[model samples]
Target: MHRVVVTGLGIKSPAGNSPAEAFATVLAGKSAAAHLPALLEAGVPVTFGCQVPDFDPDVYFPKHRRRHLDRPTQLGIAAATDALADAGTPDAGRPAGPGTAGSGTAGSGTAGSGTVRCGTYVGTGGANIGLTADFGALPHDKLPVATVPMIMPNTTAARISIRHGLQGPCLTFSCACASGSIAIGEAAMAIRYGRIDRALAGGVDSMLNPFAIASFARISALSRRNDAPQEASRPFDRDRDGFVMAEGAAFLVLEREDLALMRGARIYGEVTGFATGADASHIVQPLEDGSVAARTMLAALADARLRPEDIGHVNAHATATTYNDRAEARAISACFPAGSPPVTATKGVTGHLLGAGGAVEAVFALLCADAGLVPPTANFTGGPDADAIDVVHAAPREIERLPVVSNSFGFGGHDATLVLSPR
Candidate 1:
């Protein structure tokens, strides 16, 4: 069996775009949630969310290329482009490749050109939100000139494959919030089984307009804290309201450990274990009993050959919602049995990126293992009603063990967990 390791990490996130920047920003306990005047002006009941700050598509793609690309697809392309570059993947330049500044099928994948085939796997909560509705509403003459590629669910992964010339499989996983983590896990499985040596895996999501915001608000799953956007996502807090919707993307360059070492790539951490499961009982709500969630974590631990005590920290999938935080906390307590590890619920800072949340938080988990210190949960204020977990709040804490576990439970009862350890 092959060992999988992360050679590069990239993101277009509200905290910061680059992996280092985002990790540092989260560690400093800065919440990126903010009030969107545009949404409010559009009469969106929930005006606050965690929007990517100052993101520019013009930087990732020329106007001609991005004409039909939706907001989420643009974010995905930029993230993948950056990840491949950071991994030292040869000829992986984009936003510009050759004539288009890319050929995805344009060139060979790595340095020294050893036999290698790279794959692309991405996940999304849903397809472009506004494009289809707008196109349907507009007259034929008023519609944009770009083709219908804007509405395809697999557009981001397909575009990444074509631009980088990846010959291996290009797949998209759509399991709501677990989409990104599932994509990454499946990519690791492909490498471990020798189907592919390298891959770009992650997630992307954008649902920030009135239509989507109103949908989430209608379900009462959004924090209605427009007056205090920064503190809106208070995961595991006594007064936690609900999640703050966000839009962003994150990608990681996964390659065989032997290949990465041979090529002198910077190894962030190894994906020691991964497992995904479902509650099988609810559509949006988790099994409050936490049985299924606990089993999923145990399965992941068995895959990594580690016990609960071996985990130094946990990147909890605490969306700050009433049900999710409570259910996840109960699962954590059940899984550990001995005692829960230091938990850092980052939604308190980045809000909830939906499909992209898993991949983005996975990146945070891997980096946390590499750094050997757990960042504090942004805005968490422990109190009587908070779940009984060792939530890292108030300040960051140092830890001795290096392995970290990241969890993601999506709508439709999808649950995924990854065990990452420093190289």
Candidate 2:
């Protein structure tokens, strides 16, 4: 097995548009949760979310393509463009020698010598809201238009591939909230196993629709704290009720260690191990036994040649739900009995990005690892179950270590864990 490393990252979230801005906000313990204007006006159950403040797809895309794509696809495209540009992908038509100026290199000075061998993978919960909105704009008397292309889950990845001229392994993965992280993990595996030299991996979701809110409300999954929108997503807090659904996108560039080195890329971290499994217990509820999730973590550790004690921090899948927080806490405690390393949940700030949650949280894990600080679980007041673990609350905490685990546990018992180490 070869080594896989992250060369670049791009973030478009409620906190900010750029990765640096978002990372700084996370480290500062800032919360982007606010009363959602559109939802509140529409009388949705939940009134707030970590909605992107100034996101105008037109700023990133031209007028023509914007018409066909949805909000989720637009977010994915913007994020992917930033990631690929940051990775320094070379021109499409011309594949010249080592000294050419236009040669695509992986941020490093080394010119790409071999085939581009780039692939794309995206994870999304809701796809093509803009296209759907366009349909809604038409009068009822008008004939139903073929809006089929807009809402497909794979549309985001396909659009990304088309935009970048990537012809390899173009695929999309959806594992509920863990979709994004799983995509990154799988992309890394592809490169590590020599399937591709470079890959774009990330997730995007924009479900701020009335239909989505109504469905979640019916299921009692969304917080009904319309009074205190910011405090609604109180993960690990005793007062916490439910998760706040959010919309955003995050993407990262993964490349073979050798390829990254040859391109002189500025490495953020290495993807050491990734594992996924199912509880096979329940669809809505995770297994209380947690044997499968724990094993997944252990498997990742084994694959990375690290021990439970080697991990310094964890980017938890704490979704602010009562059962999930408890089950996840028990699993972590059981896996790392020796006072499991500092655990942090950023969803309190960004809300749950559904299919994009795992990927965005993975970015937080890498950023925290690089910055040497455990980001706080924003808006967490206090809780009995939370105090049992070293959950970072209120503010970021400095920590010492190189390796960290980012866990994403989704509905349908989907559990995925990825181990990352600083470059």
Cα lDDT computed for each candidate against the true fold? 0.85, 0.80
Q: Which structure among the candidates has the greatest TM-score?
A: 1
Give the alpha carbon lDDT tens digit for every residue of 67-147 in model 1: 768889889989998888888774643222323212132134432334465789998997687567667878888877664
The local lDDT score (0 to 100) that residue 363 gets in candidate 2 is 79
Please give me the total number of clashing residue pairs in predicted model 1.
Answer: 11
lDDT of candidate 2 over 1-423, digit per residue (tens): 669988878778877788888888877777687886777888877777788778878778889767677778888888888877776763521343544423232321222453556778888656665456656778877724536667666888988887777767888987887788889889988888877777889999988877787778887888888877777888888888889888899889888787677668788898898899898988888887577888888888888889989888999988999888878888788778788899998888888888888878877888888878898888887788776678888788999857899988888898989999986
Which stretches in model 1 have alpha-carbon errors above 4 Å? 90-113, 145-147, 384-387
Q: Cα miss at 421, model 1 (Å)? A: 0.8
Clashing pairs in 2: 90-104, 108-264, 181-359
Question: How close to the true structure is residue 357 of candidate 2, measured as C-alpha lDDT?
Answer: 83
Shift of residue 290 alpha carbon in model 1, Å: 1.4
Worst 10 residues of 1 by lDDT: 97-106
